[model samples]
Each structure stands twice: as C-alpha cells, then as structure tokens.
Target: MKKVKRRAMSVLAIILCLMIGVSVFTYRFFSQGSQWVNFTANKHIYSNGVLIGGAIYDRDGNPLVHTVDGVRKYSDNESVRCATMHIVGDKKSNIATSLQKVYADELMGYNTINGTYSVSGTGNSVYTTLDADICAAAYEQLKGKKGTICIYNYKTGEVICLVSTPTYDPENPPVISADDDNYDGVYINRALSSRFTPGSVYKLVTAAAAIDNIDDIFEQTFTCHKTEVINGQKIICSGTHYEENFEKSLNNSCNIAFGNISRQLGWNTTAEYAQKLGITTAHELSGIPVVKGSIATSGGDNELSWTGIGQNTDLVNPFAMMRVVGIIANHGMCVEPYLVEKVTNSSGFRTQLPPNKTEKRYLSQSTADTLSDMMRSNVRNKYGESNYPAGMEFCAKTGTAELDGSQVSHSWFVGFSRNEKYPYAFVSFVQNGGSGAKVAGVAVTRVMTAVKEKVDSQSTAN
Candidate 1:
C-alpha cells in the first residue's frame, strides 16, 4: 500500500510540472510572438537580413524604397537617396531607427494570429510623413558640412523634413573607416542621436524661466559693457549695449546681462525650469528614441551663471529644441512629433495613425504669448526680417556655441512660424560653422522658403 501511494504522488508532481511549463510557453507565445516571427533570421520576409517585400513612400506618394523582385532598391535620384538614407535605412541595418529596421514587423505583415503567413506575395506598405523635396533642399543647404536640419508641423506633429549629413548613397554605400574625417558619425543620425552646445539659443529657456519666476522681470533694467564680472568670473558679450531693458538684452544676446540674471535665478531655479521646458527629457518619435539634452545644476556661482547663458556643461539635442519651439508656437501645448503616417497591410486593410492627443502643456498661455512677442521682436529687430522670406512672420533665436581647443563655435538657429497657414517649427545646427545668423540661419531660411512655397502651391491646388 505504501509503494502504491508514492507512485500516485510522483505522477501528480510530473503532471503539475508539465502544466506550468505549457502555461509559461503559452504566455510568451502570445506576448512576444511577433518578435520571433519578425526576426531577421526568418526566411519568408527577409532575404539574408534584407527585407524582401514592402514599399516605403513619402507623404506625396513618392516612392523612397521598394523591393524589386526580391531585391531592395532606393530612389533613382542619388541626392534623394542620400538625403533620406538615414530615415529609410540600409540593407545591413546600420541605421537602427530607420523604417526598415524599426518597423520590420509591420512591413512584414506579422500579426499575433496570422504571423508572417498572412503576408501575400508582397509585404505591407509604410507611408511616412516626410517630404522628399524638402529633405533634399535641406541636404543641399548642408553643403557637405556635418550637421542636421529638422522641420516639423507643430500643430499636427508631422515631421516634414529631417536631414542628417555625411550620409552616403543607399544604393552604393562607401566603406567607412574610423579615421575617415569626412565620414565621421556617418552611421549616426545627428538630429536624433547627437547633442550640441545649444549656445545662445538656450537663452530662450532662461527667458521663459524669468517670465514665470520673476514678478517684475520685464520692467527690470540691465547694463552691458561688452563684459561683466559675475561671481568673480568674466562674462563676455559680442558688443557693448550701454543700458537696456530685458527685451533688448535678449535681442542683443547680451551675455553679461544674462549671466547676471542667471546669478539671481540660481542653480535650483534654472535646473527646475530646464526640466520643465523639456530640455532634460527624452522623447520617442514613431518608436525611435531621441536622446535627451543635459544640464548641470551642481556648481559654483560662476558655473551657475554660465549655465544660465547656455554655456557651462549644457548640451541640447536639435530635435528637442525644435519641439520646445513648437510648444511655444502652439501656445504652450503641442502634439508629440511622429514620422510614420499610415500602414497598409497586405490584406488591403489600411491603418492611419492619429496624431498624439496627449495634451502636454509645458508653459502657461501667458508665458507663451509673452515669449512669442519677444521672439517676433528678435526676428524683426535683431535677426532682420530680410533674412527670411517676406511675410513669413518668422520668430527666431540664433546661437553661437564656443568650443574648446580653438574649434570654431557651432551655429544654431531655432524658431517657429507664426503664420497660421504654415504652422511649423525648425532647428538648424552646423558643426564648426561660425556665426549662427549667417551659417545656420541661412540654412533655416532656405529650407523654410521651400516649405512656404510648397504650402502655397498646395493651397492653390486645393
């Protein structure tokens, strides 16, 4: 009797173990089934790691990439292929955030139930919110310089133009060596992966902080003598602006006055406002991660002053800065930027991605209005309206970030259009490019002019 009872207990234990193992397998199969099916090792949708099917098109239905008889092909125009190489991706998966790599499962038509088998002779189609012509225009403005230019519709969160330079032709990729100066950072997308010293463009954040924290900030007066001593450190300015109010200080890009303002705001307040302004926040666009900007709050009074002026240990991502300007343009609220516009499955079922509806209010309406007026004054009085297209109503700020070891300062131009018809925000950054108003600012004007022309033409056609 004892032997028989032990046998029954052993049988029960074995049954329980098998049941638990099956449950765990079932759970993973339901949760991560798509990842397994979309793996590059799969032979159905991918041919030696390259997607065998599916097509990628721009907003205007311009084909950017398509699979031709089991072979991948890019745009016929070499310039367009190079301009959008970073976004469309290459065969070897060098660009991680490219549509080919990030949205592979969608392109392969892998659903939870049907898997890759649901895919017909061809894979699904991906339609992006990018404008091929605008991207090509931006690429031309880069002029072989290493930099990035991104422009997006602030109201709809549609990224119209995103161009990163040092890109090669996707149809014929070059062998990039580590010591190749021209090909440095060729694999990385500068707009999404890199951070820059924001320069005086960061003053926008300091200005926003002042408007909210300082009660009588607009009424205050400051003096600039081309240089001022704060916390025993010398803060230099481009020119001497004898005496000026808060608005004039910004218009002149007075470092001494801003350094003094920073001293008053202190490190704690400055860091708090930087976080609130989305400078220190990481955002994801259409499943691609954007690196966040950084600021250091733990420092002496001198460091605090420099930080306030966007100098000390301050690094900003161009995309983040563009979003900040977009938020300001949208009156303190903004839709998160996205690239993928829609997807059409092989079964003829189309899915249109809705704009991000999460109402993120980073600033109060009053502060945004005040800043808008100040930025407009910046374009009209400081940056010169002639620098932009006529009647653009362009509001802008330019920054020249000084680097160490005699490297030329990085040029930065960030701003938004107040024109209701073309509600867009843009960021232009040029590495080792001197004069933000000249180099980076010119890039912005050229690209925005192209954008304005397109908008007007579309309106006429409609």
Candidate 2:
C-alpha cells in the first residue's frame, strides 16, 4: 500500500511538470514570432528610406527657403529651421498641419519622440523657377511700408516669390485670438485673406467685360470728374479725368468711366469674371484653408457699378489677382499655383509627384492679348519715361483702393515681365499707402530689377 501511494504521487508530479514546460514553450514561440513580425514590418518601412521634410529649390539647385548654417548640415534629420518659417509653415499648425493628413503614409516613417515627424526627405524636392537672390533682393528693397509682392511663373503657375508685409514668421506665428484686436496678427496671409476695394485695378476687368459684351465700348468717350450720380448716390473718380475714351480712361484710372462700364457689364457679368479668375467666393487656397473666400451676394445696379469699379463689397487676395494677370500672360489658360517640387525620403530616394493640373480659361487668347497691349501702353504712357526699362517690354496696372470713411487706402500694382525672352508675372500692394504707382511701383521695380539681374547672371554663367 505504501509503494502504491508513492508511485501515484510521482505520476502526479510528472504530469504537473509536463504542463509547466508546455506553457513555457508556447509563450516563447509566440513572443519570438511577434517580435520577428514587428521587426519585419518596420524594416520594410525604413527600407524605402527615412522620411523627412520637404524643400523648395531653384533650377540651379539653390535652396530658396534657406537653411540654418550650423545645425544638421546634410541629413534632414537634424537640420535647423529654414527661412520659409512663414512661407512653408510648420507641421503642427497652419497650412502644414492640414497637409500632413494628406501626406500621412509618406510622413509615417520618421516619427519622432515629440509626436511630430519631419517632412523634408520623404520624396521629391520642390523646384521653383524663382531666383533666390532676386527674391531676396526684392524683399530687402520692400521690407518696410505696407505692401505685397508676388512673382509667378506664368506657364506653370509656380509662385516664384510671394511676400506680404508686415509678414509674420510661420515657425513662431502670433497666436490668433478670438478678440477683434487680434485682427492685425491674424493678417498673416494678407495676400490671400484681407479684403479691399480694388480701386483702379477693376478698370482692367471693366475694360475686358465691356469690350467682350458691348460693341461700342471702345468707341464711346465719357467725361469723368469729381463725381457721377448712380442711383442718386454720388460715385467719384480720383481726379478730374475729364472726357476720354476707354484706353485713356484706363490710363487715367477714371472711376466714373469704369463705373459706367460696370453698369453695362451688370453685376452678373462682373461676378462671372470674378468667379472665372477664382476671386471672391470661388477662389481656393491651401494656406487659406480648403475653403472659398467671401464674396458679397447682395446684387444691385449700384452694387454692380461698385463691383465693376473694384469696390462695393469686392475683396480678393493678391495671389488671386496675380493669377488673373497670369491668365492674360499665358493667353487665357490659368494654371494651378504650386510651391512644392517633389518630395524625397531620407535614403535620398526620389518620387515624382503628379503635376498640379492647369484649370479654367477666364478669357479668350485674343482678349488676353488686347488687355496685355493696353496695360503695356498705359505703363509706358504714365511711368514709362522715368520708370520704364530701355530694353524690357512689359504690361502693368496700378490700383489705389479706398477704405470707406477713412483716409487710409490700399495701394496695388500688377504686371508681367516681357524681358528679352523670359516671361514672369507679379503683383504688389501697399496697405494704407497713398499712391499705388509710387508706393507699390517702387517695390515692384526693385524686385523686377533683381530678377532681371539674376537672369542675366545665370544666362552669362551658362
């Protein structure tokens, strides 16, 4: 009986030992397999390359956004912030944050401890046609004085340079407050958000609209003076423009003459033109957030007149206006504007992104040509003798928009470069500046001169 009991106890001990061994083996096998799977997954992700930040480069491989001198020299992993602190924006907020959602898969490989990933070396680098030195020189010349400066590649809609002051740094942008007092700080993207009366700039639109719709627009001569009564309200021209035809009317910035043309075009046509050019409510800007801007909907004869004259509830960004000018320069086709060239990964592997599609034709090629000619003539006749380049041929338009009930007004200038063989388009605006031609033109000239010099240097170098 004693032997039987001991044998039974031994058998029970053996069974318990077998159970513990099986459990240990099972645990080891699954744990090892899980670790292996995780390793394989991560390896695949990094195999393609380490993800990093995006960049903008000129045709010559010159960095435009600029880099900090001492930080991570080559590897995007440790480089300091670049100049585009305001332009390219940050990954946390503003335009870059929203862009991240769209580029999630690409940005996934470079997750950092801070929960933010570097987007620099994920794919192709953005290649801009803008000359960096030219952009720098232009910005330097127009640093002070409230104004906007924008340069665009007419063919590709690639914005070479777009600066609006007082400019804010995107890296450390002022916190936008809910209070109205914070409006100034919120003016970070004045080139795209701030609404203003276009003043004389609308004359270009009026001229085009009237010519397209009215047969006798060019034939009619209208006298413009202190004021003209429209719907019993007094609408005034800047100066005593006197009696002039359409061509002279534009050159003089005749408000009365343009107001009449606006009445003829009607509010609907004016709105249509605005929509075609992606202005007011129809325009879409990635930085401005994926939404359309506000355009006044109260349509009236007087409102139409105001709209035609670039006033009465009409507001647009400088970028949008520049695009309108680009359409004419590009023979009516308005291409989509893009700042990024291509994104690359950390391993230096490149991926070509599909080009942004060119959309919408606002005006016919013929209209574009005529408008271009008219703008050129107006510039030559007014500032030509003093400001005109001897060998450069260009078309330009200036605007002095007013702020109702206030002496302060917004000044604007838009034009295209017709250099020897290169074509570039730009827009400039000065907030609360008295004269568009003087305040805005001075800045525009500096930029254009720098651009020309850069082009010349590049040509010589090549």
Candidate 3:
C-alpha cells in the first residue's frame, strides 16, 4: 500500500512538469515567431527606416510634440500662424515608412529562419532636456503665425523645444506619391530641414568672428549713414545710422556696420568662424538629414559684406541657430546635439545612450562671455523696457532675414534663461514675420514663462 501511494505521487509530479514544459515551449515559439511580428511589426508603416527623426520628450518625460498620422485633420485659423508645419515635419509617414521598409531590417532587430521574417522596432527612447510645458506654451503663442521656436540645454547639448508653424499630423500623415519635393506638397521641418537667410541673427557669427580675428574690435567704430558701397555695389541699412560700436551694431541689427566688419574679417575668416560654430558641415552629426545652408564664399567682397549681416545666400535652420547660441551658453564647448535620452530592451534592461563627443573650445571662454554679455545688453537696452522680462537675466540674439522678393522678414530669437541656473536655452522664428524683438521676443517669453511655471510648481510639490 505504501509503494502504491508513492508511485501515484511521482506520476502526478511528472504530469505537472510536462505541462509546464509544454507551456514554456509554446510561449517561446509564439513570442519568437508570429507573435513577435504581430506585437512588433508596425501595423501601419509610418516611414521605412526614416523614423522621421524620433520625437523628443522633456526631462520630466512629458511628450511635447509628435508626428501626425494621415488619419486625422489638423486645422489652423488662429492667432498663431501654424507651429506644426515646421517642428512636426510633414505627413510623409506612409512614404517614409515605405521607403524605410527596405532598410527596416537593417535598422531594427528581426527574427528570421526557415523563410520567415519578423521585425521589431529600434526599441529606443529619446530624452531631451526640453521642458514640455515650455514647448506647448511656445506653440500656443505662435499657433497662427508662420514661425519657429527652439529651446535647448546648453550644458547637455539637448534640444528642448523646436516649434515651427504650419505643422502636420505624423500618424495620419498626408499622402505623397513619387516625385513630390515641392514645399507645398510636404511639411518641412523648418527647425532642421529648411534653410533661411539668418538676417540679423547671422550677426552672432559676425560678432564672434570679428572679436576673434580683429584686434581692438571693441574700440573700433564703423561709420554708417543708411547705405555703403562695397566692391562698387551699393548696400543699404534698414535705417540711416551714424558711427556705432559693436554693441550698438548688434542691438540695432545695423547692416552697414556689420558689413564693414565682415569686409575686414574677409570671407575666409567668416567661413572658418561659421564652421567652428557647427554651422557648416556639423549637420551630419545631429543624426538627421540636414538641409545644408550656404555661406557663399565665392561671392567676393560684396557677398562677404552681405553675408556678414546675414544676407546674400547665408542660410541656416532654426535648430542649428539654437546650437550656435548653446555654444555661447556653454562657454565655448559645443556638443553634438541629440534627442534620444536612453534605450531599453525587452527584458527590462535600460541602457544609456553613447556619450556625445563634445568638441571643446570652439570659442575662447572670454569670447563666449563677451558674446553673452552683448546679447544680454541687446535684450535689456534695445528691446525696450516694456518687452524685457522683469526678473530673469535673459541673454538673447534676434534676427530678421530678408528673402529676395518677400515683403515680410523671417523673425528669429535665440537665448538662454536665468543667470544663476543657465538651466535652459532656446531659439524661436516666425516665418515671413515682423522684427525679432516684436514677434519672436514675445513668443520666447511666453514659452520661458510656461517652463518656469511648471518647474516652480513641481518644486513646490516636492
């Protein structure tokens, strides 16, 4: 009787073990095969391996913006022009996904054996130093206008908010068949994809180059009376101004003074300074297909003169401008800007992104400090007392770029917040808009205020 009881118990234990083994096998087989495809393979392809340059979230892990799927409708008939047009890019997900399909396996993990294939996503998450509240605020303020707003972390080289007007939905993106390259057919990611004349904003580069190359730039004053002749070509300023110092040249966006300074530095020096600021070939390192802007060195003295004041085919994108400001904020170090904060695996293992290769000493510490001070002065002294923020030490540079025949100018503002923390930095542009101070300044302030409000609220809670 005892032997029979022991045998029965052993049989029950064997049955249970077999059942467990079968369950394990089934799970693995399904998970590694069809189940994986069902779970991972995109039900709707947005863009092949293009990935639309992954959307970014703030440090607090809130999503500020994303691509729109073609499935929905986006409307813009408000005070703000259309922030989505630039930052959110276009509704090319379907075409992007289709084009990426060929490269998908190469970029993403796949399960393949015995004539079967399954694809899994890249499984990476982008962490940006941008505060979400700030991005939304900027977008909210610039909704009806053709504009752009960019924010970054100067210390980390992380972009906070990149808002461009005239946005589109990424998920239900608009359909684009073959041979569609016109700007109207697609949404341009103006922040990185579209290039514009830097206008007054280009002066930042001119200032840095002049200070770096020319001796006694502070003491030198360039005489200006509305227009000046360079290489026998007439160039005019927005206003008829007299002799001015470097500080005033920047504050008033004086073309004649900047043009003279550029003439002194020459084209070679201007190009070199731009390259150092990560404006030239540095786009490749940003992990996006950047539209290269031209600083026409071949245009001789006249071209150089115009380029100095951000005219005559000197092109740049909003995000790139933000990076240039970031270098100034970081006191000369310019890091390769990135969006992905971290990556995680299916097993719940977290991995930090590869460290950004930071190129140090793009500008001398003194040069950066000087530039920052000048930017601050421009904001405080020139923008008028009413526009200035009461409490913050906002260092900024405003730009107004003239496009050949266009009546309105593209407005731009790039700046860093707070004297104490230097916590965040950003750039904003309003397309075919007014002056940088009147339009871009208000947008930047709104975004900064929103970001501060959110941060302060969180601090109070903690």
Candidate with best TM-score = 1
| Clash pairs for candidate 1 | none
Candidate 2 lDDT over 1-462, as tens digits, reads 999999999999999999999999777755553333223235432232222334445545665432333111121311112223234434333433223333434333332232223354333344444445554555565555555677877876666775545544433445666774423433354565455667777677667777688888778998977698877788888789878988888888888888788887776777777666666544544323422433454566667677778878777767777877888787777877665555555455554455555667878888888888888878888757458544557788999888878678888888887553557788888778878888887788777877776667778999
Which ten residues in a row are the worst by lDDT in model 2? 71-80
Q: 82-153 in candidate 3: lDDT tens per residue?
A: 333333223333222121222232223233452122123223234445445555567787766666787766
Lowest summed lDDT across 10 adjacent residues in model 1 is found at: 350-359
By TM-score, the better pick of 1 and 3 is 1
User: What tens-digit string does per-residue lDDT give for candidate 1 at 352-416?
Assistant: 45545555899999898889889999999998888798777999999999888889999999998
Off by over 4 Å in 3: 1-58, 62-130, 169-186, 284-286, 351-359
Backbone N/Cα/C clashes per model? 0, 21, 43
Q: Where's the lowest-lDDT run of ten residues in candidate 3?
A: 94-103
lDDT of 1: 0.88
Best by lDDT: 1
Error at 296, model 2, angstroms: 4.2
Considering lDDT, which of the candidate structures 2 and 3 is the better prediction for this target? 3
